[model samples]
Target: MSGKAIVAHANLDPYERTIVVSDIHGDNQGFLETMRQVEFSPQDALVIVGDLLEKGEHSLELLHTVMRRAQAGNVYMVAGNNDTIFSEWYNDEVTDEEVHDYMNHRKNIILREMALEMGMSWQTLEEVRALKAAVPKRYAAELDFLNSLPHILETEHFIFVHAGLKPGPLTEQDRDFCLTAKAFGTQLHRFEKPLIVGHWPASNYCETIINVNPYFNRNTNVISIDGGNGLNRWHQINYLILHREHIDFGAYDALPRFRALDSQEPSKDPLTLGFPSTEAEVIRKGETESICYLPAIDLEIPVANDQLYNYKGKRYCYNMTTYCLPVQAGEILACCDVEPRGLLAKRNGMVGYYTGRYEFLSSDDLLLKKEGKQP
Candidate 1:
């Protein structure tokens, strides 16, 4: 039951257009707003590549939305690693260490979110055990929704899976492998058709620049669409629209919006970005922070010292960043924070640092502006 295939097939022939997005991770407003921006309609097939739940503030709400939309029959979901996390735990498929890792790794976990919704809490193992007992009855509807999700949705032109596939026919791949495969973009595979996947962020493969647009590896015919959502300061919900063999993409973020009043040239110096970051090796230790080496750019930078660790004899920080982005005026950017050093922002769907003046957008309208980039 754990490793078997739960394949779901679709032709998508009836839909006028098809839209694919991945790894929303509970950014319900961003997902809904982007749906509005894309002008999604009932005539369209909305294919979510996976990781729909967990790691954000609104998993339950987002789940409700997807569930409601799915009833209309045009919406399809491919089970993601996170999407099946609930079933994994409830079924006792994970060890205690795995449970600890899950608890410590994410903030705003969906299970805890659901537990809170049911007037319960899960900060410790005891609470989790109690919730496990209560969940089958109390959270039956949500659990059924999660359990019923398929791992693959194959259409005529594309194979939509949350993770990568191994070589073979669609019916041959394991459900868990399809849901948990890592770095399928890097592997060599002879696919029957073009494949689209999430789980691994597109940012991981963008070495020279900070980009999160849907990545197409024409060599292997695999497209990676995870946009670093729910995992970093710079991220978006990436959309991939399909029309026959042609493909189009864009990204949306829930970050604070800013509009530029004046233009500035990009940094002339050679800069390294997102060599698939949020992980780095420590080069030197300091009192409050550590100097770390990012392997992708071969650059060393300072990181907070508190999180450095050794796993299986290799050193890595749980979180790391070396983002420096270019900016332009009159365009909107997703602003992360304003520090004395500079402004942290993401523009044109690329996440990085910007040292420029920008105007803030009113949260309600996203149109009003005020001159500021200073903290």
Candidate 2:
């Protein structure tokens, strides 16, 4: 949040593929099980959605796995609110004494209260305690890596946020803390591009999502993969895969080489959100097509030497001789060009343009429902 030391990654191509995981909550075994459910390849990208620490067994092991994957050039991490808090304490951004006091005095009661709220029974509460006792200290290098995490990751087709963005085009000013906080029950719409998130666990959405992670906003492009794991009695671990090309759907119906080593089992109910069971099926499905409800209206008026386009009281000029207009009124105007040179347009005399690399999406092509307008 403070420094450019952690420069966020943004890719112009929205269709770029990746995977997301959430709220590991320190169940290393659950994390491994979740990984087993999804198909991973050397070419694929992996992202940890957040809540990677606190009140879970083998927190250190989970961190180690993240580090290992990152070192192997496939994984990325965003700091969840809890990740941030523990990290702050771990890095002395929050005092060690403060965390120690909380762990000593309020840890058990707090775990029980949260578990009850999350629907854990007394027996499950013991599991949470057992998980806590199994927790080990984190490595210093991993803390540095966590501290260096990005608040947002952008691809050509999708964006991954720790929690959810505040809405609208992402900007540097979007606060990191808010980025990782809760967004329950708000009528938040997914971006025109897909948004992947993890924080809240999903118990009811299994057959669709495979674990505790909720898939509520998948229809709208907001996927929350926090399958509560150690935090919920359900004890599901989950992540998702997006593919460049479609794979077979039949693979999901087949059993895996390994069922979960833990007590957690798949729910009897069918997953309502349409998650493919195995990685191959996800690949076969390709990327989900995003529907943008926003319409495009082009304003053009013919003129001899120079012509102008106006929309919403704004004016833009196109020169038949030298340049194309970059904006018509308030709407963006794209340049038409040949292959040797891509789209070229000038705005406000700055001569703005993109060549060979820019991929433009028409407003009509966007998943353009206004924020808070979608279910």
Candidate 3:
């Protein structure tokens, strides 16, 4: 009942492989498909590093799926910051004013969705109290699963936490920090084993290029596997698989696949590899878009100025890419964003702006085209 750090030690020897994933953010389909791509089996153990219950379209549904799987066994989950915050609200720890603000921009919140499903609303204090009690009683299993989730999962070779950790004894680490650690990847920590984390997307750690793949910092033995799911359409669920002393990563998303129709031409100007995936300082703020400079890569790019305010004194650009894409004929990619600048596409885990010819590599599109109709 007292929201605190519950560190758990895991033994994955029984399974043929130990699969680690994080920041699922309620994308149940993407999670399942990523496992399918990796050929997930009963023989494999899955460790969802965290953020399993919020942000995507199916927060509560994803929770049920994870609950069912965990009940079936071979599945372990850690508490993400979103899960922790929700727990705090549910336990009456959050003040009325705080809850009001939290529920203000209500979108994809698990608790809100659960209440809505039962024809309940939390706009008023009476409604909040009534639904809070009713929700847990009706969905006792889901609540219990969230309540029982650990903040950290440890093994001989790896230490899995939703967010990052402070360098020290695992038990003494701050509960909230472990649940919502920021920039833990950049922080130097010499753990005996590799520390795997989510919450913070792996691409944000990249300064020069856009890579949603797991980031392995050999120097610190820290591996970040949050592939920016739920943050944007381009991002996907990153899977970290450990098998036979080898570690690999895979990603899956809901974006439609496509193939290049023509080869890339030579660029006259300098090649912009990609935009800075992390934070950037605002240089010129525009009405619709602002120019921000990312000190990590010394690149200035235009970003959507759609935020009402900054969180934790940190600002981020959701859409910022100036790199031109070069694609060979037949190169496969997933369509991410489309703009007058070019089609923003991700190929081989790297995202870039493509001006070249391309076609949707989908049967649905083919079917529509075969009927002589524009899709």
Candidate 4:
């Protein structure tokens, strides 16, 4: 089958609390702190909504923790998009050429760490490539654990998935969509039970973090808990605590110590994602003073001719020199006027940037756009 089946199920006692988290993205400190705060015990149930690896310095540590808890039968996990990518590598489903391509696209960090732990110093690209070839043989057990993860988890009153499900009977939902879906049509909300998903951040559905105390929803019943954990400056890791009668939020401040590891050296040139040289030249020549709207904050902010400004405590500037602007949901940012070269925005605080026009759309609007339907 193209998508994995729902491999596990659980029936919680009526009085037991189920604490669920999504998109940990390898923040071991944040995960540990959250667990400590919640006083997570073996008796209490913990469900993680996937994306347990990548983009952080402690990917292996985080995976070990989850595997240990899971083995004890206290944790249930549903695979996220990132988890699926690593699974492919572990299963030997990808060729060396395919793995090399993925490594080039800023995905070598995970493999490099694994190689180091195996007593190899992969200091060069070629060494990293060599390590990729040995992954399936060296990490067979770990790969098996990742492959065994289910796509969905269900309770009498709630559905736990890595991503939102399609609008219809739960049994009929596509496995791939449940693992990686970011936008869902209103039809998805018509289902009888509330859904909890994590692939997309809560910022995509709400304009501000202050407004997300209750929950952020593309649909009223589909609550998203991905607090752009490792991806954004302003947002922190978010966890949702579910009770029989109510839900609560558990947020951990970003670990500045760990976040510093992700900082990059300043780039002299503007970052462009596959834009042709000729097209980029045109954008620079035609760049003009424009007022770009901050859809998340519902405010219109003016971009200077060629300077950075502080919005919501973060600095933003339009690179007339380059077409890309580093902006994500829930942050106060100055929008750039790069129409032809395309704008860069962060999706759920993921490592890579998503290239698209400088247009803001909520998850619901995004669903309509993807479906070729009017909202």
Compose the digit string of candidate 4's lDDT tens values, residues 27-101: 888899889888887768888988888877788888888888778777888888778766666456775567666
Q: Write the residue-wise lDDT of candidate 1 on 1-375 in tens digits.
A: 557677898888778889999999988888899899899999999999989988889988999898899899899998898888778876778854576567656677777776777898666777767777787887688889889988888888998999988888778888888988887888887576899999998877765566777888988999999988887666788898898667898877767777876676665453544323445787787766678887755778776654566666666664333466656677787776554335666777665666667767765533223234232
User: What does candidate 2 score on TM?
Assistant: 0.50
Judged by whole-model lDDT over C-alpha atoms, candidate 4 comes out at 0.58
Q: Candidate 3 lDDT, tens digit per residue, 294-371?
A: 766688777655532354677655545466666888988787765544567787787777787777767774323422
The segments of candidate 2 whose C-alpha lies over 4 angstroms from its true place after superposition are 1-7, 10-17, 90-93, 106-138, 176-179, 203-213, 218-220, 245-375
Span of ten consecutive residues with least summed lDDT in model 2 = 250-259
The local lDDT score (0 to 100) that residue 144 gets in candidate 4 is: 82
lDDT of 3: 0.76
Better of 2 and 4 by lDDT: 4
Report the number of backbone clashes for model 3: 0
Cα RMSD, each candidate: 4.2, 22.8, 4.7, 13.4
Clash totals in order: 0, 19, 0, 0
Ranking by TM-score: 3, 1, 4, 2
Poorest stretch of ten by lDDT in candidate 4:
274-283
Assess every candidate by TM-score: 0.83, 0.50, 0.84, 0.64
lDDT of 1: 0.77
Clashes of 4: 0
Q: Which segments of model 3 are wrong by more than 4 Å?
A: 1-4, 265-319, 363-375
